[model samples]
Target: MLERLLDNPLQDPSGYRQRCFEVKQDAQTDKWWLYVTYCFPAEATARSRDTVVGVDVGVSVPLYAALSHGHARLGHQHFGPLGKQIRNLQNQVVARRRSIQRAGRRGVVDKTARAGHGVKRMLGGTEKLRGRIDRAYTTLNHQLSAAVIRFARNHGAGVIQVEDLSGLQESLRGTFLGGRWRYDQLQRFIEYKATEVGIEYRKVNPAYTSRRCSECGVIHEGFTQAFRDQHGTQGRSARFECPACGYQADADYNAARNLSLVDIEERIRVQCA
Candidate 1:
């Protein structure tokens, strides 16, 4: 059936199938979704031990990545000019959509009836604009994933640790902004690229990583710069002081430490079991 569908491809089919790619039926959505897989030999020697990598996912910059060896900072490019360009394109798409809706409303008010053809044409234009934005986003995601792979290979990072935000969509319901973060998309790209390079990926619970002080294990509920500067005077920037020991570190680096610690605990549990 899939082969037949592929044989007579539609102009814009919901999805398609091909070798090295699978569109499996899953519980999340009723229809099948696409996934591609690639396999390759490991680059490192058998004697080279594993090094852990930590990743922090966010909405502003998308991803922040680090490794234990300090060889590279993956996903830094994502926060610069390219990211601004993508955001601008997305904003244009949103404005165009709103304009189309307003135009439809005006047509009805002026003509005492909806101008169906005009409304359809306006919506078609919005769709084309949306397609361009989506393409840009897809391209950026691919670039970011490639950068991550290169960083891992250069740093000799064998394992990648990610926060388990599996049910984030449901958990964020009724919040200020829901279903806006593309965490699942980023995760899928990371997993696929890592597997292609024979790198191990793991997810751990993201509890108290950003709140607890990395040096002293002190839990500060709102551990922001304002709190740190007033209490411990840890200077400006992403660094914070432990208040107990005056140990200073970058905020993201501290979070990464927690992720690594949790990963080590999980590994020990698995070995014991």
Candidate 2:
């Protein structure tokens, strides 16, 4: 399988190094198999001469990129729904296991010869359901990551800025950021892909990205946090309406615009010295 993918003439393999081999057991198959990891040279792509994009990532929206001329939302509309499905299925599986264990512990059921077999079958079914849910989410995450990298390349962006979400996920479990495991996974994909293509990646302090007015730089002190739904209505979610400048936009987009200015601010600080 690895050999065919690498040797495919239609795929570009010029800038990549020799494939590194590894043997691992796949979760789906529970069997050992050989795998090849592909790598790329650092300078495979020449750096772009212009453009910098700020990507504001959120639990609700996933990503909102602020570009030079306009903006784009990364990831698919169904991503949120799919995530909900995965999480719900996960919870259901846990509950199902607990119920099965409780049944096994009861005096009436434990005496039956079929008890052990019945519990095993129930557990197996739950495990299979959870696996399918996880696979769906994994597929979606890969797509989101690829879309973000492509967005940067297509825009001729020299730099792609993302928030440092290190501790935030731990702090926001149960919320959108609660899926820290998968969110971080997607982030790593974007980071490496961007670097491999010669686009610099950076992380900025996300503290005030949402609260500060993107138009005038005034911190709203306490702006109402809003959300922009799939239908594009701000009233449905957390939002920011800057009282100082009366600039209204989705809370996440406002953050993205502010994030986009991080590179400019850094350059000014450097020149002043």
Candidate 3:
């Protein structure tokens, strides 16, 4: 794959753009790696616009893509091992930093001259941690975005829809994922990649997507956080039950399904009125 993708623009300047290369060292492995970013002209796809693939960005799932008209889906288990790895890295960094802080404070408490190891070391450690976490997020975005585009192509979908999350940052104020800006980054990756392959990418209003039933268009007001707590379905619960129509499915997937509809916003307005 590397050989095929890395085409020499000088040798074959037909359809490839000038490639840019970056050299970086891995924070975990302390090994240098080279990354090449290249763009190649892609032929416009002949797929019809009848099929719309809706992608849902979530906390635990990362991404969930589904066809608007069919049950075809992708990215169900994309976050399993990879998401755990990111969380574990974050926890370790936080713990170690706290330990460093505690150790630094002990010298002042004991009234003894201490080795000034904490300040400089903490800065260095933080830089390394930031690099590692950023790299992990980039990797996750690349993987999930590729999966979304591949799913659309496999099903010959011409249009791809995602939630408009301009206001999600405020809601995500207390979360690590939100702090890292992963949700919008993931959507951007999908958008550019899909556009490169002649797929129309669009953002839809996200109101009531999670609570509205995809089948019957009923907005289940009972599916709130309190309802989830009452039913013990909080904290990454996969099940979403519509109280009105009894439509049940994975919550993220169901949201993706509703997003696939071009008329989702209009449906919500009509239903609520």
Candidate 4:
């Protein structure tokens, strides 16, 4: 049930209507948020469009964006340091979990545990660490997403294109490569910000984005599972090679370009429309 009334209601409140609402509370802070649904025409939400930038999220680089209208750089390395913090935090959590398991096996308990005491020291530290990790994630995600959108807009891009990484999780499950491996959260942030700013957001299936050469039509030989490793630039290959046409470019940049090219027809159609 809703705890309070809405400040702005588009539909009639008294009349029965098909509507939905969601209420969520922040687990760590105990803060509440409400989300509601509203229906509106496409033109009412659509914005002016000129160019689209195709973005590639990867393990080596935090972001590799290819603009439809202009040149694009290869990497957003600012996330490297932030990712370090996140990885360290995750390591600490793993270590704590191990210690907790050991203690449980040994039947160790705090002095007040038998007195109905709450919040064990280890549990408290873990929760506090979890909170810090959450904040770091939120900060990193917001900064990365905002900067990407700003960069696109500066390059005359009004629509942002990204890979639909719905199935990429298993591939990136373990390694946190240079703090650049949070594709799902990053993409979600990008999607929401684009919508909030009245820009366009589109995602395409991310298949063969790395293997297919951006310049040539031929698919490159291939990269191996070693490419999935986090150490020493395995995933973030500095360069890619096309055997058929001898085309060479930065690996991440090549992927971004391919993503941009993938949506060329649609981008052109939308601009013309």
Candidate with top lDDT is 3
Q: What is the TM-score of each candidate against the true structure?
A: 0.66, 0.72, 0.77, 0.68
lDDT of each candidate versus the true structure = 0.60, 0.64, 0.74, 0.63
TM-score winner: 3
* Candidate with the larger TM-score of 1 and 2: 2
Candidate with the larger TM-score of 3 and 4: 3
How would you order the candidates by TM-score, starting with the best?
3, 2, 4, 1
Q: Write the per-residue lDDT of candidate 2 for residues 135-249, one digit (tens) a residue.
A: 6556766766777778778777788888777777654442343443466776787788787788888888676666777777777766533323333343234567788878887
Task: Give lDDT tens digits, candidate 1, residues 15-109.
Answer: 33333667788552355778764333444433223577777653234455676655356443545665666567557766976977787786777
**Count of backbone collisions in candidate 1:** 0
Error of 2 at 133 (Å): 3.0
Pairs of colliding residues, candidate 2: 225-238, 225-239, 226-237, 226-238, 226-239, 227-237, 227-238
Model 1 clashing residue pairs (backbone): none
**For model 3, how does the per-residue alpha-carbon lDDT over 1-273 read when each residue is reduced to its tens digit?**
356555553636445554677999977669899887767666466987989999876534556788988898875465576566656756755776786676567545665333455555555676666777677777877877898899999999999999888867675433224454577778889988998788999999888887888888888887764454355434464468877778898877888899999888898999888
Runs of candidate 1 exceeding 4 Å displacement = 1-49, 58-60, 69-72, 75-78, 103-114, 169-179, 224-239, 262-273
In model 2, the worst 10-residue window by lDDT is 226-235
Indicate the residue-level lDDT of 122 in model 3: 59
